[model samples]
Target: MSQPPITPVTTPPPDKGGDDMATLAKGGRTNTLGFILRLLGGLPFLFVGFRLYGVDEMGRFAAAFVVIEIFALICALGEKRGLAQRLTEGIETDEDTPANLVFDAMLVSLVVSGLACLLLITFPAIIFPNGTGSDFDMWMIAAIPAFALTEILLAAQAYRYDIATTVRARAVVEPWVKSIGITAFFFIPALAGGGIALAFLAAIYAALLTALYSFLRTYGLPKAWRPRPRYLSKMTSRALPLIGADVIERGTRLLDVFLLGQFTSAGTVGIYWFAKEVVSLPQKLKTSFEPILAPVITKNLKTGNMDAIASQVRQVGFWIIALQAGIALTLAIPGEAVMGLGGPEIVGGTGALAILLAAEVIASMAVVSESVLVYIARKRNLAISVGVITLQGTLSVGFILLVQHWGYPEGFQAAGAAAALFVALGVASLVKSLVLKTLLKAPVSNWRWPLVWAAAPAVIVGFIFTEFTPEWVEIIIGGPAIFAAYFWVIWKYGFDEADKVLFRKNVAPIDSDLNASN
Candidate 1:
């Protein structure tokens, strides 16, 4: 059966931008739902993990997993960034897009994955190393095909506005499945413990199988899947910068974790990972919006609709900052309670979580620029990324050296790492926003409300909560109230009539905004 032609939504008439902001805020809400799903998926794994393996053991499990993941990220370099562009023009022009892009994408994916596999094979000591255990090494080998296949197949899903499926498959089902299976394995005969790696390999393959089927069902099978030699060469040329961009982006995120494993104990990596996860949930929660935002911004750029482009750029940024600031305030204010959630040994991660969240607070702006620039000014965008990541690498390595020389506390090192990340991201955000202003002629100033209204209120509320509220009670109850009150103030007072309309898009725009007049 043939599907209806894909239609791009008409741009809302830009004004004060209340309704438009609301619509995209709603997109953040959807991302929040995806986050909840991810949390639900992760909790089962977390609970089972703690019960079965405990914190220190779980940390060791994470060591091999991080390397395998970094390898996977390296393999994904080009294909991920380039997909949004390939379909941008076609989606907007209402063209009969060819299915062959999938094949071309897959071919590129295969070559990269093969290269990664060869590297892993040739440098087993370098890749898996001697200390992380033979079980982990074996799991990495088993996981290579599954990780590569699942990630490679995900681009087509992004092209189709089918984010919910990707969300369900990865964030929802996969983790949940891993949790349940691993929890059961704790009772397995003779295998006394340490099945976490095996559980992950199983869950990943399950996700891979499901994702591949979903892609095939949505788009027809690979008739045009194979790229012609000439066509392949041309597409590869366009993708080169993106390969560099993705390497810098994903590589930097994983680089620290990999290095921490090498220099520090698996236990330190565990504490660091715990803290990073707390604040990162919100960042990861918002990630679902990236796929949708990418195509929309790319299409707007292709059509030269400056209004649509600016509106989206502003709206997504506004929404992301509002949400992340809320999460960051929660983590930073009562930093102890969040870290304590993992157990007493992990309490040291609190400072790390606070710093990482602060860094993510800055990074939210850069992520908005990441999607917008990829379509509107990919070359300029890529250059900014190169600069930022270069800055990050130098700062990270140098800071770690400085800290090692000083012999600081475990948590102090995390704080320094987070501090380094904050500085790097803040600089990067400024550069990218400036680039967007110069090239795309988009107003970076439109993102100011989030910086001022949202960030200010949350910071104030966090301060008040810390000072006035009692310790254990505040974390248990008052902590949540602080978060709630801050958002209420901003969403009610900070947001104007334009903001109100987004929630009430189902009703008349005026009706939605006026509801706020109360």
Candidate 2:
């Protein structure tokens, strides 16, 4: 079929200062809500998996889940970010409608997911090299389209700044459905073993259906549903850089598992996976900003407003670092107890959990920096990711081998892998930050001394409680007390004007007086 005429996208006019801040604040609120829902809905599944099925079954499920997620990312073709960029450019220039963008992304995702399903069906061994069983293998293949479509729909809604749709489908509906389904299936003798995996598959389809209904309600149906081959070609080409960056990024998360599978048992992989998943919660706070930041950055880029772009980056970067630092301290201080919740067998991953959490904190700068660079210097960003992941892979394998050869305990083997991850990520973050600084000719000063000050007290309190008290008291009481102190310190001393703005409040008058006196 003939392609529609391409509309040339133009630069959008610069937004006023207050307007920009207001946009960010709104995005932050919605993203935070989504984060909370995800935590509430998702945590139960983790507990259920570990509590009911135990480590080995959960490990097999994790392996299958990882493979399915990787394929979904591939089929998404980077539209999670690309769609936002495209829509921002198109909307600003009035060259395309929301319907068309959604339609195009949906079409591309369907095609790519179909092909991925075929590939998995053709070579089941690729996903389940260790044999995930026939039922799980089938469930994994069946879930591909649903997983891929949910990604596209969420991206589409994010383009409209309707993050609540994602929160509803992903955080609320999907996880809850899976959790309930798994719990229900536990009583059935025949379905008990692979029930969690099946529940997960059912949940994906449910979420996809919810997303579709939400999309239609919010944006209505596509006006002209034309399947233009050239449109698909253009989108694929545009998304290739993003695809590479995403694959490399996700590879960092899964590389540990893949390598561990070779060296360690399924139970070990399950332990590592749980630790990684827990540490990743804070990372989500950073990602939540992307859907909002993309449109703002793209708009500024169109206007050739490098100053605005840098300011946004610095502000958002600092916000993320400050929050993440506090979260890392909170989680890592009671790491052992937190892991213990997953059962006695998984508590051995405490060291790995602490190391991984630290890695996320160190890597926050690079994560925010890459958000900007991906739009400005796509190829360079991709190259940096490739280099980082290659380094990570090498170190991970070497560390595993070294630990095994040195006769370290099996538990420490995971710690060694995690340490390798921390080192690679820390170095990569430093390099990426420096490169971004050079490009922007602006310093990314997200770190403040007060963040350290705030974290110190929280960590001290958390450590005391975790060490001296029972696990329940440590997690329930200590966590809240530590976080309370952290937030109070941050409020009294660490918060800047931008942070105050998020709360719709100005700096306190006493602080202003203190500043004036100084």
Candidate 3:
């Protein structure tokens, strides 16, 4: 008996543009649930780390992790978005399978990541600009390979429209493991100093394993797979713009932490990092669409279906903005209460929390637009990303120095960084959307008046809770009340017939034959 020939992941027929919407909705619904679970899982780590390890130690951990994550992104080489194009083009040999292409990416990632790990391990200071707690801190560099590989594997799964695997690995497995591992490691007196690093290592590797298992199951073993040096070199060269774009876009978020660690005290960095984590919940909503959107856009581009592509950009853009706006309102309105959840010492970051949440909401268009731009105009997109990050760096430093000159505290400096991010992202969103609109020759703006209507009521609801109720009540009651008010308005007034598909329980299934055959 012989094994079956390998094929790309199953997707709905390209002709039914409606089916594409259905696929997008399914992914969005699944990841929306993941965001909730991730919120639950992530909060524990923040509480435990802030309460037990204290701000200085966690700040050190955040500083180091930022460096490692950036390096990991570089090693992954932008496969998260780029791989969908590779798969869609089927540019490799007819005998070569999707799994083979993935393996080639994995091989390249491993080589680059291995080199990164060695470099970081040697310098160590690059990872920990603010000195290390223990020699075990160097071991955190091990996360680079795992993190990079997990990115590629998860991208492979997303190509197949299997976002549940992503939800499981990222939302369910990674955070919970770190939460549990951090709590567990803290109990051992000797390990307590390095608990955050150890827990992060554990989390990254666990997610890697989860993603690996899913990749093998879905893509199967690559047949006749061999490394082709010339081919891989071409692939890597082509990926340079995407790699730059991914790093620069991600760098905008991490640069503040990196710069803050250089200028501010560890405690200040800790406060800002906590606010960033809280804002990340809404940030994840935009990403929920990225993996799904990539393959959809690639397919549409294949047929020169500019209308379908534009429609998707609008549809997904609205979905992300609507959800992010609701989350931003709920979180930002009671910013102090949310930051207070970390610890009383962390409450000073309330302004930063609000600003970061607003940044996530405003950055929605840039993220969505980039999803298309990466495939169509990657170099131009990369150039714009570079400009945005440069602006963010300039503004962050200037604002921080201005606050210091004005005799404000370090917490105000942290808020200054968040403010810079808000402005830079607003610039990125405006420029990127305009560029995308020009190329697509269609309207791609996600702004709708209902968003204003929804947010206005939610803000009032949140104001009443914050003004009249206890801090605990404001958090416990106000959060839900604000969300209810925001989404209720969005549901009644914002959602049109097509938009409602995101919430529909029984979307017509993809063809069963496609499922079984794949």
Candidate 4:
């Protein structure tokens, strides 16, 4: 049978540059709020899990989590950014809507996730390479489907410029559930051993439910939707580059843990994983711009508005670098105090924590550049991603082995892994940003002298507290002082009226145009 001719959905008219900035700012503001909430909510779980569960158990959990998240990202098929491009390009028929398309991605993800669960179930050793703390550890793979589906649903909402939904699900519901669940489950004698893993499962499902509610509210049910295997195969094939990019990009973060689980002890992995988690808070600032950047960039691409894409990328890149730099300095300067909060045992990871925080700051440019490159230069972007993760993996292993050969402690090994990440990410940022600038035919560097100006006072303030004051004072009073000093300089020198848009609360709401047809 012959298929009907496919027609592209007519694109919406481009909004003024100001409106685009407003949309990006709105997303930044919402996710920035989410970042704070995530920090507050996530810290409790870290504290309780380390102090209550102990480093060895948490280390095992961290190893398993690395596997779970990697597989989950694979199952998601890169819809985190790809879905926005798909929706922006439009569906094939009148009967098929964005809801139907989302369902397509979800259905595929579920099938893959089920297979993944079965594979892990057949060989539980893959997840617990060292050993399991409790019998219930095997069930953690069940969260894979929920985690994958949540990514799709959240990406769908982001297509409508609905970042608040992501904020609510990821920042508010997810972390709090895990934190509370970990604490609650700890008290039950039967569940205490596996409470951390159980809490993680609960959090994944909670966030999925939260995302589904908002998705249905916005997109409703699919209208006359039906499965198409041929179309699905095509969709999956088209997403290969994106999938590889997403997996490899995330792999760099987890590869260190996986390698360490083999080369070092479980407790060492726990300390290193704690540092990764702490640095992830600032890392979220870059990703907060990604979902929203996709739709805006795709819309501009459809119209040949390369300049608009370049401008948006620069704007978002600066915002991320500035915010991440300040946060990194504040945390890394008082690194020992922050790491000690998890427990004194965790204080050994202070060096790793400082290096990982710096890595996040440097990676911001690569992150923002990839947002544009994924659309205009998918293969090239994927190539760069592949290259960097390979470099990161090699360096991580080499560093760990060298440190071991030198008779260094496990803490030094962990810091070695972090230093590897720092080098790889700095290389990635420089190369990726250059590629993006070349492709866009415009200057795309995010660096500004004001960043140095902003950091100088922050460094001075942070050094004062670290040298003169107590740990509590450094964390409580000095952290804020560092932030204030950095941002004050940023506001006075770095920000123009456009950059100030991120601070404004009264911008017009960014709404969906998904239901439009032309």
Candidate 5:
């Protein structure tokens, strides 16, 4: 039997201009909405877990959760961003429909997830050495297909510029289901112990259903779909570099947990997990941007529009850094109080929380830079990611061992690990930004002294509040006050027309004002 001829995919000429502004506006709005929903839906679960189940049980759940997430990342096969890039290419050239692209990704994801599941089942000890028990470990494996499928579905919608679908499934459906399920299950003595893991599995399945429904509603069902070896090879080959980068990128988060499991106690791991979870909230913004940014970057790359690409990277990088910096300041200002809310046992992780938040702030540049480089310099990008993770792993283990050698208390181990993470991430971000800057010959960071000026006053105010006021009072009064001060300074002196355009419905007036001011 003869194979179908492959349709040649061609790139469309770039728009004259204005595309970056439009994409940023739409992406920013949707991502912001998603971020808020995630915060609302997700935080409740952490509070419930810490308040009800305490640190140890949550630690057990955290252990299993890490394994499940690592496998999910593996099964995702980098399709989250890679699929967006491929879909953009197909749509631009009319080589394939959305259904075709989604179907291809789904098929690959299913196979990879299946393989991963089998491997986990075969060597459960290798992945979960502390052991989440056989039943919980099985549940972890069961969630992989759902996890992988949801990612692909959401990426498919993102390719269509329908980020709201991702927001709905991930932000609204998944987190709420988990939060509610975990709360309800805690009431039953039989199910109370593993409620977190159970709720997590339930949430993934719910998200999978939601994603499938949304994807089909938007793209319709696949037609005349048949698996082709050649097509699979092409897709996998294109996705391989991304798979390496994505796994290593995500593995950075899991590395501390894995190493801590080996070198520290479960209770300490739980405290660190809680702190990591809280600090990681801002990271949702970066993930939100990637889906939308991938297509824009891919389109620009196709047209050889390096200038537009750099401009987009710089703008988005600054946007992420600005927001993350504010969030970090807010969280880290009342760091102990923030952790206290989780539970008394976890409050000791305040130092870790502060350090991890700093890591997120520094990582903004690396995240946005890698997004652009992955398309243009796939090999180099992968190399950088590998280097970053290698450095992170080395620093993490070394710092952990040093703390032990110094006879520091176990409670301080997490902070030591977090400090190592900060150093490793700082090094990685600096190097990655330089590489992107050299490659593009344009600025990859839009940050200026004005941002620093804005941050200084906010930090000072936060410090004063922390020293004098109660935890609740500081959080209630200081958090918003700091953010307002930061934004006020930014608006008064730092924000340019492009930044203002993110807020305005129409860019023409802002553009005019910018010209007149100039």
Candidate 6:
């Protein structure tokens, strides 16, 4: 149960003071590999979920999935982000601190999760007024703590510089379990709807065991490990801010699922969710970096190195914009082909998918801004989150009105939600940029070149590909071209001579303590 944070090295261990360009290239390659593996591994589970559960049941499962995640975030209370920063910043590498802290965090989480599960199990009818799930659903919700712990532990591993464990558990093992379980649901009638829930419990535990083993092997058990009150206090103090931020951020996403559950049926929830999944596929590319980016950015900030942080922030933004844009473009342009594959049952979802994908494209900037805010000014990060949630709620209400005024159609309301979210994302991105710039006293204006250059090329790729190949190939090919264009534009125009010099200098160093932070 003792997990410690470690540093991540990009490629073949750097030689003495390895070159900065080599490290960045290696880091890019590392992220690229993780992205590929996640996409390949996640697809089978997603496909099987679609095929086995059809649309309505899949929607029910998806809604619960989001709800359980919210509960998991509550259990975490932000230790994942907080610990990643603390350990890597080389504040006080007692090593013993993090190892024991994991158990303490797990203990607190166990209590919170247990109490929540008890209420859910015993009072299912009492809590969920606009009931979509039964007592059976409540039981499924019990797995929340273990799953959340698995997530935190994975983050711990990444900070420990053991990223492959995280990738394997999330990308490979979790998906493999889910895909096989979903496939099994097709044959075992007993395993049909609720079975998806049980499968999640099994998968989480399996992943937990895998992570526990990996963490132990990579970083020995917490030194002189024993439950202690003072240790818990220290860890909790560090994580408190993180806890608040995590709650609001995740709560915002969960609010969407919960709101849908209230006014709509599982069937409608399914429709909205199907549209979300289709439109949000671009998110997968960024998801792999979720564990890695925070620590990397935090390391840069520890040295009071604003330039490196700004460079990374802009570079990541460019990549996210290019990739997310192509995905959103493909989904929006050929909405029918995408959801029609879900079969006629979910075909009413095409319009919703188009609107949601549009939202996702705009949301890319907010996605990258989040990392910057987290690393640079954590308290301000909380403020940014509040701003995001406030905007999201405001947009949600107006969008609902739009749907009502537009004359209700099957997917019209969801389309309204997507439109609202898109506007909210734009506001959040601008706010995030300003906050980051102010925090670092750096010119984030540098992020524009990659975006400006990628646009024309992206448009050209979309039009020509739509005319020539199928939507799938368009998805396959369009993303990389846009990304390539963005990278070239950035390397050429985004970086100044001084920027390249800094990039050139940061390779391997004999300074172990500094390298540990890196």
Top model number, lDDT: 3
lDDT of 2 by residue, 1-518 (tens): 65434333233345554456556667766676777677777778889889998887777677767788888888888877788788776676775667777788778888888999899888876666566743654666788878888888887777666677777887788889988888887788887767787788889999999888777766676666788899779988999998887777777778787777767777877898888878766777777687777777776676676666677777777777777777777778888888988899999999999998888888778778888888889999999998998898899889989988998876788898899889878877888888888887877656778887888789889878987999888888887788887888988898866666656633222222112212
**Which regions of candidate 2 deviate over 4 angstroms?**
1-14, 91-96, 505-518
In lDDT terms, how accurate is model 4?
0.87
| Every model: Cα RMSD to truth | 5.0, 5.2, 4.0, 5.5, 4.8, 5.5
Per-residue lDDT of 1-518 in model 5, one digit per residue for the tens?
A: 65434333333334433655566667776877787788778888999988887777677667767777878877787887898777766776877776887898888889989898898888876566666732553676789889988988888777767788888888899999999988998898888767777888899999999988877777777668788889888888878898888888787777888778777777778899989888766777677688888777777676777777777777777777777887888888888888888877788899899999989888888888888877778899889888888888888889889989998876689998898788877877898889999998977775677878888888888888899999898878888888887878877787776776666655542333112212
lDDT of 3 by residue, 163-258 (tens): 999999999999999999999998999987788989989999999999988887788888888999999999999999989988998999899999
lDDT by residue (174-227, candidate 1, tens digit) is 887888777876787544454777678778888888787777666655452445
Predicted candidate 4 versus true structure: per-residue lDDT over 1-518, tens digit per residue: 65434333333346766678788888888988898899889999999999999989989999999999999999999999999878766643443688888999999999999999999998888888899999888889999999999999999988888899999899999999999999999999999888998999999999999999888777778878888999999999999888888887778778888888878899999999899889888988989888777888787787787777777878888889999999999899999999998788888899999999989889999989988887778899889888898899889999999999999887899999999999989998999999999998987888899999999999999999999999999999999999999999999999876777789989653332211111
The better-scoring model by TM-score among 3 and 4 is 3
State residue 231's C-alpha deviation in candidate 6, in Å: 3.6
**For model 6, how does the per-residue alpha-carbon lDDT over 88-182 read when each residue is reduced to its tens digit?**
43325645456665666677777778887776667654334345432344556767887778877877776755567876676667766766665
RMSD of 6: 5.5
Error of 3 at 177 (Å): 0.4
Local error of candidate 3 at residue 118 (angstroms): 1.9
Kindly give the stretch of ten consecutive residues in candidate 5 with the minimal lDDT sum.
Answer: 509-518
Candidate 1 Cα outliers beyond 4 Å, as residue runs: 1-28, 54-56, 88-98, 134-136, 190-194, 224-227, 446-476, 500-518
Stretches of candidate 4 off by over 4 Å are 1-13, 91-95, 507-518
Model 5, global lDDT: 0.79
lDDT of each: 0.65, 0.77, 0.89, 0.87, 0.79, 0.62
Counting only residues 3 or more apart in sequence or on different chains, how many pairs clash (N, Cα, C under 3 Å) in candidate 1?
A: 4
Show where candidate 5 strays beyond 4 Å: 1-16, 92-95, 505-518
Candidate 6 achieves a global lDDT of: 0.62
Q: lDDT at 230 for candidate 6?
A: 84
Q: What lDDT does candidate 4 reach at residue 496?
A: 78
Q: Kindly indicate the candidate among 1 and 4 with the higher TM-score.
A: 4
The pairs that clash in candidate 3 are none
- The TM-score leader among the candidates is 3
